[model samples]
Target: MARVAVVTGASSGIGAATAARLAKDGYHVVLAARRVDRLDALAERIGGRAARVDVTDPSSVREFAQGIESCDVLVNSAGGALGADPVATGEPSDWAAMFSVNVLGTLHVVQSLLPQLAAGGGGTVVNITSTAAFVNYEGGAGYSAAKHAQHALTETLRLELCGKPVRVIEIAPGMVRTDEFSLNRFRGDAERAAAVYADVDRPLSAEDVAECVALAVGLPQHVNVDQLVVRPLAQAAQHKVFRGPLFER
Candidate 1:
């Protein structure tokens, strides 16, 4: 039997890419997400298993964890910026949704699997947060705040789980180029999504983030990567970017 890995948000983007990579790394990847069709297709392509999981629901996560015999790695890559714009114009629903996924969802998965992780003796927990966790943005208030809370949780977990063999690491990616990322940001506004990357020569890709995750996961059980922050070359800072003229034709 292969080492088991539970990956959330595995239908697309970083989650999907990481799931495939981990399977190649000799683990039987179990993917969980809200999108069933996408999950089925991805599972077929990668020869892995899929579960319809809503990370926000404790019952769903509990059952999902129980289904796995022994989970070796838990990747919390199931969050995004939903309606995370200026506070004045943001709706309460959007704020609630962001907190539910970014904060509660992460907690739900961890809480459900803490016993499993502990029972297995040593495992890895990689929380996929964003640069917003350490930085600031005028329109990224809510998103940043939630990531900040996650960052705190990561640190606390690390401290509490010390000497227990569990490695709690946090990867903070910057400007990852993904369809879901832009779509989630713009709520499927293709024009706006295109505009966000119109000028950038290149941005972070899912593979790039997945590579980082693989590196962190492959480390010896004694080695622990506390935190990592990565961004594209063009993205020197979150607010600053390199762009070309829209009509430079």
Candidate 2:
């Protein structure tokens, strides 16, 4: 029997790419996301399964987990930044939403599926965080704070599960230019989203991050990659990005 891999946020972006990659790697992929249409389409394309999952809703996640007989891997990718407002003027609702999904959502999913993971002898849990988890910047207070909390959760989970068969891992990507990430962050401002990658020319792609996830999870069961940080060559750090001709210099 093929090992089952459950991936959240699989409707698009890194989540979708990771599902595809894992499918190609011979695992039975269960694509989970809020959009049924996209999930159905991707499941058809990859010969996988789709489940409508809203990670923030515990009952919804519990129902989703109940359907799975076993899970060898759980990829928590159902997270995104809501707004880029400064702390002084940031909307409380936006911060709350971000925390609910990026932080609480991860916690809920991990708790719900942990038993399934353990049932299969050992499994891997991959948390898709951002460089913001470690680096603070202007206008990124809310999103960064939520990711930092997620990072902390990942670490604590690792420590708590030290003797268990499960492995906890985190993948932090920088400057990934996905279709909806920036647009959603800027609240549908096309021009602003476009400008976020205008000069970089070669920002990280969803597939790039997916490849990293695959690499870490594909390792031997006895080996665990605690954390993996990935970034485009143009991005040296959170506040540093090379643009235009200067990028190559």
Candidate 3:
């Protein structure tokens, strides 16, 4: 039987791209997301399965896990930023929501599916964190805090699974330009979202991050990539993104 790979947030963005890549790699991918309509379409295209999963809900995650007989890889990519308000001005609700999905949602899925992952004898857990997990900046306090918590969670899992056959990996990307990430963060402000990547050289695409995921997971089971940080050439750092075109086009 082919290896089984579960990708959450598979309705769009990095999760969707990773699902497609893994499917192309010959794994029987399970595309999990709350958006069943999108999931169905992607699943059919990739010859994978579609699963409705709300990572933030423990019961939902539990139900999803129960349907999986075996899992060789689990990618927790069901996370996003809510707003760009300063710490003092950020909405408490936004912070809570971020924490719920990015941290607790991952926790629920991992806890529920860990047994199946371990049973596979060489399972891999890939957590799609962000550079915000390590660095902080103004107007990003809420998202940064949640990602930091997720980073800590991934690290702790690695330590706890020290002797287990499973490998815990963290992939952090900076300045990825996806269709809905920025628009959702700005609450549907198209111009604001567009301005985020205005005139900058090629920002990292969802496929770029998904490629990193496939590479790490494809490595030998004994090889554990503790963390992989990916950023576009135009982005030197979180605060140091080059706005103008970097190459002659």
Give the candidate number with the greatest TM-score. Answer: 3
Write down the lDDT of every candidate, Cα atoms only. Answer: 0.87, 0.95, 0.97
Candidate 2, 1-249: lDDT as tens digits: 999999999999999999999999999999999998999999999999999999999999999999999999999999999888899999999999999999999999999999999887799999999999999999999999999999999999999998899999999999999999999999899999999898896899999999999999999999899889999988899999988754445
Q: Which 10-residue span in candidate 1 carries the lowest summed lDDT?
A: 240-249
Name the regions of candidate 3 deviating beyond 4 angstroms: none
Question: Candidate 2: what lDDT?
Answer: 0.95
Residue 105 C-alpha lDDT in model 1: 94
lDDT of 3 by residue, 110-198 (tens): 99999999997789999999999999999999999999999999999999999999999999999999999999999999999999999
Q: How are the candidates ranked when ordered by TM-score, highest leading? A: 3, 2, 1
Candidate 2: list runs displaced more than 4 Å.
Answer: 245-249
**lDDT at 80 for candidate 3?**
98
**What's the residue-level lDDT of 5 in candidate 1?**
84
Total backbone clashes of candidate 2, pairs 3 or more residues apart or in separate chains = 0
Best by lDDT: 3
User: Cα lDDT of model 3 overall?
Assistant: 0.97
Give RMSD (Å) of candidate 1 vs. truth.
2.6
Residue-level error in angstroms, candidate 3, position 124: 0.2
